[model samples]
Target: MTQDPPRLSVTSQDVANHAGVSRSTVSSILNGKDARFPQETRDRVYAAATELGYRPSHAGRALAMGKSDIALLLMPNATFGPQLQEGIDSLAGVAATHGLTLMVRFADPDADETLRAILNLRPAVVVDLGVLDQAGRELVQAAGVRLVPQVINNESNEVDLLIGRMQVAEALSNGRRRLVYASLADWRLDPVGPIRLRGAEAEAASRGVDVTHIHVPLKAAGATEALAQVTAGSAERLAVCCYNDDVAIAILAAARQLRLAVPDEISVIGVDHTAIGQLVFPRLTSIAVDFAALMEALLRELDTNGYGPPARPDLRSSVRLVAGDTT
Candidate 1:
């Protein structure tokens, strides 16, 4: 297949010509620091830029700003849920406000090449999702790059603790006796999944609740048989604390196949208020994470924490129960 010719990138001069202004005027308005231009002129320049789909080159901006114009986000390869994607969107917005652009690169933290690339770029800020040790921290600080580690993963277990506490409390409040955790078996979600499982198990153990660990596959078919067996012939009211909304959806299908009434016979609570969860039959009740708040926390950590020490930023995502027909 013939590839399309590279679309000519619209430049600042092009925008200036379209807006009937000097290139320097376009540049000044784009900088947002110069207030010499009138508000109307600025608006006109912005409108022209939007119409042209003009984006400033990061290297150009970095040269002008005397620093990398990028907030580099690691672990771009991971499957980002809607909430994390929203958080990243908020991060990008914040970065843009600071005259920095957001860039994503796929490389595991353990790889030496990733560190080398990070040091080479020396981005304005590095928001990390994977492991970073003391050496990595020192390298980043030595290179004058600010690093924030493990924002989404509950390395400190605070967010997990809250999610676990909420799941246990909500199920117990509704008089659920047997609590089964839909533990994820995917290798992609290792530490986070285990951390969440621990949180739920800890809460259940404290309340004299028995939480059966069911290692469920990522797909819909992997869960049906296991769920059928678990909910087969138990006298107690069961509530399955799902790993996430996808697992919860699998449980829903499994419940349907087994001919069980939703909330009446078997209740289900999911984490992550995914879009599909809202539209499903007996709409999914989920512990919706506060992505906006988490984004704030990430920014705060970047500013305040800096790179003095290599530690997981102590952050917790605020959560709320979005009630639905499921539980």
Candidate 2:
């Protein structure tokens, strides 16, 4: 009796044959580089692959494509926590689909070692997370490495502010009149923290409301003392607009230590929409930013601005208000 063809793994070659195309064409379409193929041909390849149960193995595909697909990210003093790692993982997954690999490297904030390292690797794409200075940019140009500065400019600067404003809007929509702004006392986020605060303040002013701004450390110990006046004095509607969920949750912990009630006495809202926020006694209301889309936009820009030190690299993030018991 005839038996099934000797058990073997499926490859792009099988898909190519089924689609009446070369393996290279199948590779290009599967890798998301579909500009070369017409709409009908692209559809045919996708259908044939699905019918043949073809799955592309990422191993060694970068070299097979004859392209320099390595991407390096140098960010000094990065937290690399779950939230940040989620963003990094999204980037790695997207890059892998495009036959590229993304590597995140930690560098010293006080020295030029990061730039020196960048020069050594000569990656096809470099994402600088506010650590690279002017000299770093110049050296990257000299080394022929694509330098992408992750700075906010006219094109995408409002996104940072949008996060804060959304937090305030959520509070206001919940019938809360009094709002407070809580920012991290970190230098690394200089203009970013101030920018978001300013946006919240501006929106509050427009609505004829007053916002109390407070800067506190990352820890939860001293937060109670710093915010005791607001927590103790007000029986009125109150909410804290924290820089991120970390700070917001810290505020919650601090309030607990002071015997202050949440939602009843105060409501807390933060950005980042971290997963930890969900586990708290009262789920946190947060401004969720689409980090995957943000990275996708920046990476696509590399094709256009790949030659010189990267442009401001229009960084955009889609913000959404996630409702929870906190608000």
Top lDDT hit: 1
Q: lDDT for every model? A: 0.73, 0.71
Off by over 4 Å in 1: 1-41, 44-57, 60-67, 133-135, 149-156, 302-317
Candidate no. 1 TM-score: 0.74
Best by TM-score: 1
Per-residue lDDT of 34-113 in model 1, one digit per residue for the tens? 47678889899999988887878766555555557688876634444578877776776655555456777777635677
In candidate 2, how many Å is residue 47 off?
Answer: 26
Q: What's each prediction's clash count?
A: 0, 0
**lDDT score for residue 268 of model 1:** 86
Tens digits of per-residue lDDT, candidate 2, 1-327, equal 964452236777888899998876776677666776799999999999887777654343334543245678766674332566656766665554444558788776656776666665656677775566677777776766666543434345467777767778877886856789988766553545676788898888878899998876677776776677676766676778988887888888888887767777788888877889988878998888777766665666565544454444344436678888887
